[model samples]
Target: MRARPGALQVGSFRGVPIRVHVSLLVALPLLALSFGGALQQAAETADVPPGALSGHPWAWGLAVAVGLFLSVLLHEMAHTLYALRHGGEVHGITLMIVGGVSELAEVPKRPRDEAVMALVGPLTSLGLAAFLGALTWLVHGLGMFQVQFALFTLAMLNAVLGGFNLLPAFPMDGGRIVRAALTPRLGLLRATRVAAGLGRMFAVLFGVWGLVTLNPFTLVVAFFVLMGAEGESRQVRMKALLERVNVEALMTPRMVGVDLDLSMQDAHWALRHEHVSMLPVTSAGRPVGRVTWAAAQAVPEAQRGGYVVRDAMEDGVVADLREDGWAALRRMAEARVPMAAVVDEEGLLAGTLDWNDIQRGMARAEEAERQRSGPGWPRERTA
Candidate 1:
C-alpha cells in the first residue's frame, strides 16, 4: 500500500525538498483539539475565567493548534537543517497525527554527524520552551494576566512535547541518538535492530495501556509508532542487502526491440507473435524509448497502421551498469517507474531490469546461501 495521503512538495529550504502528506490536513484539526483542550484545562487550573480569553472557543482552539504545529515544524526543520549542514540530503518533512518526521536521503556517514542531527530537533524544542517560559515569567512579573497565562501554557505544552520526543524509543529523536551511539560498536544493522526492537516494545506498551485505559489517542499513537519503526527497519535492511549490487547482475540482457519508425500495426504483430511484454524502441542501434503491450492496445485497429512506435513509446531514465545501482533502484522505486534500461560499459543498451528481476535475483541469492549452508542455517520466515 502507498503512504497515506499522497505526498506533495510544499517547498524547499537550503536545497532540501519539503513535502507534506495530504493526511496532514486531517491531523491539523485533531492537533488543534488536543492542544486546545490542554490549554483550556491549564487556563482553568490557573484561575483564569473562560470569558477573559480573547477569542471564542473555536478561535482559541485554532490558535493553540497553530502554535503546536509551529512548534512541530520548528522541531522537524532543525533536523532537516542539521542534516543539510552535514552534507546529507533531506528529502522532506512530514507532519502526522503522532508527530513530525524529517526524511533524510541517507543516514549520516559519520557517527558525530548522526548524533548532531538526531540531537538538534529536541534541542530546538527545548530552546523554544525555555524562551517561552522566560517570556511567561517576565509577563507575570509585569502583572500581565492574559498574556502570562497563555505564554505559560504554551511553554508547558512545548516542554511536554520535547520531553516525550526524547523518550528512548525507536522513531524518536532520542532513539536515533541511541542508534548513533551504538553504530560504531554494533554496526548499523545491529544498531537499527536494537532501536527498532525498543521502539516496538514501547509501541506495545502504548497499545496495551490504551486498551486498558480505553484511550483512543494512545492506541493511535501506538499504531503510528509501530508502523514507523517497522518501515524504517525494512528500509535499512533493503539498503544494506542491495549495497554494491548492479543492475547488470539481474537485468535481462536479451531484451527485444522494435524500430522506432515501425507502425503500431507492426508493434502489435510483434506483441502477438513474441512472448515479451515490452519492447525497447530503438533507432540505428541507439536506444530511444519503450513500447509496451498496453500502449499498442490503446491504438484503434484502423489507426494502428498509421501510428508509429515513437507515438506509443514512453521515455524513461536510462543508467549504465557502472553507476550506483542501489541509488538508481531507489530513484526508480521512489518514482514508481516499472523498469530501467541497463547499459554496458560502453554505454550501449544491454538489457532491461524490472522490479520482478530484482526480487528474483534476491530470492536466488537467498536460496543459494541456504543450499551452501546445508540446511542447518537458521532460516527466518519472510512475508
Candidate 2:
C-alpha cells in the first residue's frame, strides 16, 4: 500500500512505467493451482481429453497467472489514464496480488474527481468482464470450449475484481471514494478515520472467514487490507500536520556545495566529506545543478579528471523556505531528486532538504504527536 521498495519495471504504458514487486511472484503458484483446477472443470464440461492438461500443468498455471496480472495492470491503468486526463501526474503503477496501485503525483482535492478516479478501475474491470464474456461465448460457440478455460476464468475473475474492489476499504479505490464522499460533511480527517475504520472491520470479517474456511489467500488479502488501512490513515494525519510546517524547519543547517568547474573527483570528495548523497553545484556563489552519487559513480575512474561537476550534475527542484514541508517533499519525490536546495526569502540557499532531513523531521513530528495524544496504535473494532 505504501510505496514498495525495488519494484521491478516490466514495461511502460503511455510513458508511465508498469512495475511488479518480487512478492507478486508469490501468487503465481497459488493462482496456478487454482486455475489448474478450474481448467479441469472446464475440460469436463467441454468433453476434452484429460491428456490435454495432464501433460503439463506448469505451463497452463503460469500462463493463467501472467494473464490475470495483465488484467490487473489494465485495471490500474484505467485509474492512471483517467487521473491524467483530469490533470493528475502519474509516477508509475505497481502490481502486487492484492491489487495494482497507480503511483500518482497529485491527490485530487475535489471529491467528485476522487470518486470518478476511484470508480474508473472497477468500471474498467467490468468492461473487461463483458468483453471477455463475449469472447468466451464466441469461442464456445465455435466448439473451442477447451480453449475457453483461461478466457472464462479471467472473465469470472474480472467480474469478481470489479465487485471486490467496491467493498470500500482504505487505500482501495472504494475506500478513497468513501473518504471523498464524506469529506465535505464529516471533514477530511474524520472521513478518513471512518473509511479506514470500515476497512478494519472488513479485514476482521475476512480474517474470521478465512479461519472458518481454512483459506490462506483470504487471510493474506485481509492482512494487506488492515495494514493498508492503518497506513493510509497515518499518512493522511501526517500530511495534515506537514501542511502547517515550513520547508526551512525540515532542512539541514549546513550543506556542501561543489564548484561547477570542479572535477568528478572533487565532487566525490564533497559528497563524501559532507555525508550527503548529492552536492549542490555552485558557480559564482549561485546554484547551478546538483551531482548525485549515482551520477558521480557513473564516471569512469580513469577519465574522472576529464569530467567536471557540471558534466555529472542534473537540474533539480529548489525548495522555497516558506513552502509547505510536504509540498516540497512531494516535488522532490516527483522529480526523483536526492536533495533540494532550500532557499530563503531572497532566493539565496539557506539550507538543504534531503531524504535524511525529511525522515528525521517526520519522525520527530510523529514522536511529538504521540507524546501529546498518548501513544496508541489504532485497533480494529469488532462490528
Candidate 3:
C-alpha cells in the first residue's frame, strides 16, 4: 500500500502550515488587550485630542495592536527565510502570546549556520525600528506633526519588541546565539546544557520578581521560558541518542495477524485473550489492512458475529524496516499514524513498530553502549 501524506505541507513560499496550539488562541485576546492598553496610555500621555484618530481610545489601541503583531510576523519571516537559505525547511511560523516562533525541520548542523539563523530575526526587527525612526525624524523636519507622532510610536514599539526578544533566555534569539557559539567548541549537548541552565536562572529570577511584584503576566512568561528550555534540551538529547538508528532493530517480529476471512468473533477473541490491540489483516499470506479492538467494539453485538475482519479493518500504510528510523518517525508523526507495519526485503510483514518501541529501544541501546565503554572494559586494538 502507498504511504499516506504527512500532515505538514509545503505552503506559500515553501513554508508549512502549523495549527496554532489552542493555548495560543486563548491568549490572543489578552495579548491584544495588553497592546491596546499600551497604546491608550501612550496616547493619553501625549495629550492627543480625544476622538482625533478614532472616536474611541480602544479603536486606536486595537490598530496599534494589529501593527505590532504585523511586526512580529516580519520578525518570524526573517528567521524562516534564513533557515531556508541554509538548507533547512520551515514547518511554519506561529504567533503565540509571548511572541512568535519559526519552526524548522531540523536545527542547523553547523555552529556558524546556527548563529546566523538565530541573529537574523532580531536584526530584522532592529532594522525596521531604525528605518521607522529615520522616517519619524524626516516627518518631524517636514512639519508633518500627525505623521511624525505615529511613526515615532511605531519606531519605539519595534525597538521594544526587538529588545525584549534579545533578553538572554532559552528558546529566545539571544539564547540561541549563545548555544550556536558554544556548539562547535563544547558540542551540542554541552552547549544546550549551558544555555538551558542560564535560561532557568533567568526564569527563576523573573518568576520571583513577578510574584513579589504581583504581576501575573511576568509569572506566566517566566514559567513558559522555563518549560520551553527544559523541553528543548530533552528533545535534543533524545534526537542525538537515536540518530542513524533504523526501524528494523526496534520492531517486533511476531505481530498479531488475522485472516481477512475471519469473523469478527475471532478478531474479538484475539483482541481480548491475546491482549493485542492491533491485528494485521491478511489474505493469502499478505497484509491487506489493520483491525483494532476499537474498530471491533464499534459493531453492535448482534451484527458482530456476521461481520468479516476485512469489513471492519482499516487500510493503513506500512514502512520498510530498512528505512531510517528518524525519517519514519517523522512520517508517522506527520501522518498521525499510530503504528506502521514493518516489512522486510520481500515486502512481507516482518513485524510492527510503534513510536514508543523505537524510543525505548534507542534508550536501551545507548545505555548498553555507555556501560560497555565504562572503566575496566578493555579497549579494542586498532591498527
Candidate 4:
C-alpha cells in the first residue's frame, strides 16, 4: 500500500524526521478536556485549598495534555535509539492519536535483539513514571500544590502508558515481545501468525467490552488493533514470499509504452486495445512519465484529441530493474503510485510493476515453496 501525504514534519531527531498527524491535533483538545475534568475532581478529593488552583481546570488539563504528548515522544525515542544502537535504521517517528510509532527500516534479525528493542519503550515510560512520582513528592513538600498535582497526574499517566503497552497485542510493543519470544521455536513468519492471532482475539474482546460499556474510544482502539494486526501479518508474509527475488524476476518483462506526443484520444485508444490500465509515456522511446486510462478519461472526449499524452500523464515512480523486488515495491508504496516505470542501467524503459505483478510474483513464490516443502507448509502454529 502507498503512503499518503498527511503527516506534518515538525523536526528531525538525530537524522530521523519527527512527524505529527492532523489526527493528533484533533485529539489534543479532547485529551485536554478529559484530563482537566479529572484534575478538578482529584483536587476536590484531596481537600486542597481553593486558592491552590484558583482557576478553571483547562490550564492544568492543557498542560497535562502537552506533557503526555512529550512523554509519548520520549517513549518512542527510546525505541528508536535502541534500534539505532543495534545497527537498525529508523525511517522516522510519527505521533498519532493512538500513540507514537518508531518506524524501523526492518525488523531485527535476532530474536533477542527484537525482544529487547520492544521492551525498551515501555521500560522508559515506566522509568519516567517513577521519576515523576519522586519529583511530585518533592514539589508537594515545597508547598506547590498545583505543580505537585500536575506532576502526580503525569506520573500516573506514564505508568498507565507503560502498563497498557505491555498487553500482548499485535503491532504493539507487547505483541512484538511475544513474537520475539516465539520466533526461535516457530520461525519469524509462524511466530507472527501466532502473535497476530492473539492480537485479533484481544481486539474482538476489546470491541465487545467497548460495546457493552458504550465507550467510543475503546472501539476506536479495537478497530486500529485489528487493522494493525492484519497489516503486520500481510507484511511479514510478503517479505517471506519475496525473499531472494529481484525486480527483474518479478516485474513485467514486456515494455508497454505510449508516445509522449500521442494525443489523449490516441492514448485512450491504446489503453483500450492493450487492455492495460496504465502505460509509460515515452519521449524518443525513453519513459518520461505514465498515463493511465483514468487520466486520459479526465479530459473531455472532444477536448482529449487536442491534449497530448504528456499533458495528461503524471510523473510516476521509476524502479531500477536490478534492485531487489521488495525494495522496488517499497518505493512504489512510498510514492502511492498504481504502477512503477522500470528502467535499465542505461535508463531505457524496461517494464512495469504494479499490484497485479507483485501478487502474481508472491503467488508463484508460494507455489514454488509449497512444491518444495510439500502440502500444508508453513502452517500457523505456536511455539
Best by TM-score: 1
Q: How far is candidate 2 from the true structure (C-alpha RMSD, Å)?
A: 4.6
TM-score of 2: 0.82
Clash list (residue pairs), candidate 2: none
Tens digits of per-residue lDDT for model 2 on 128-195?
Answer: 99998888877875656446766776787788888888889786789989988888887677788989
For candidate 3, lDDT tens digit of each residue in 1-383? Answer: 11213222323445446334444555656655665667655754444444444434455555666667678778888898888777787767766656777777678878888888888888899999999988876665564545665777778778888887787668788888898888777778778877888889889998999999997778988988898789778767666666557788877785447889999988998889868788777776567778899999998878888999988998765778788766666666655567778777877778877867887877776777679879732222221
Query: After aligning candidate 2 to the native by TM-score, how far in Å is the CA of 336 from where it should be?
Result: 2.1
* Candidate 2: regions farther than 4 A off: 1-4, 42-55, 134-142, 211-214, 263-277, 292-308, 311-315, 363-383
Q: Which parts of model 4 are misplaced by more than 4 Å?
A: 1-6, 44-51, 85-87, 244-250, 259-277, 281-324, 343-348, 364-375, 379-383
Query: By TM-score, highest first, what's the ranking?
Result: 1, 2, 4, 3
RMSD of each: 4.2, 4.6, 5.2, 3.9
**lDDT per residue as tens, model 4, 7-28:** 8989988898899988789878
Task: Indicate the worst ten consecutive residues by lDDT in candidate 3.
Answer: 1-10
Worst 10 residues of 2 by lDDT: 374-383
- Best candidate according to lDDT: 4
TM-score: the better of candidates 1 and 3: 1
Pitting candidate 1 against candidate 4, the one with the higher TM-score is 1
Model 1 residue runs over 4 Å out of place are 1-5, 37-39, 45-50, 141-146, 264-280, 291-301, 311-313, 322-325, 334-336, 369-383
What lDDT does candidate 4 reach at residue 74?
94
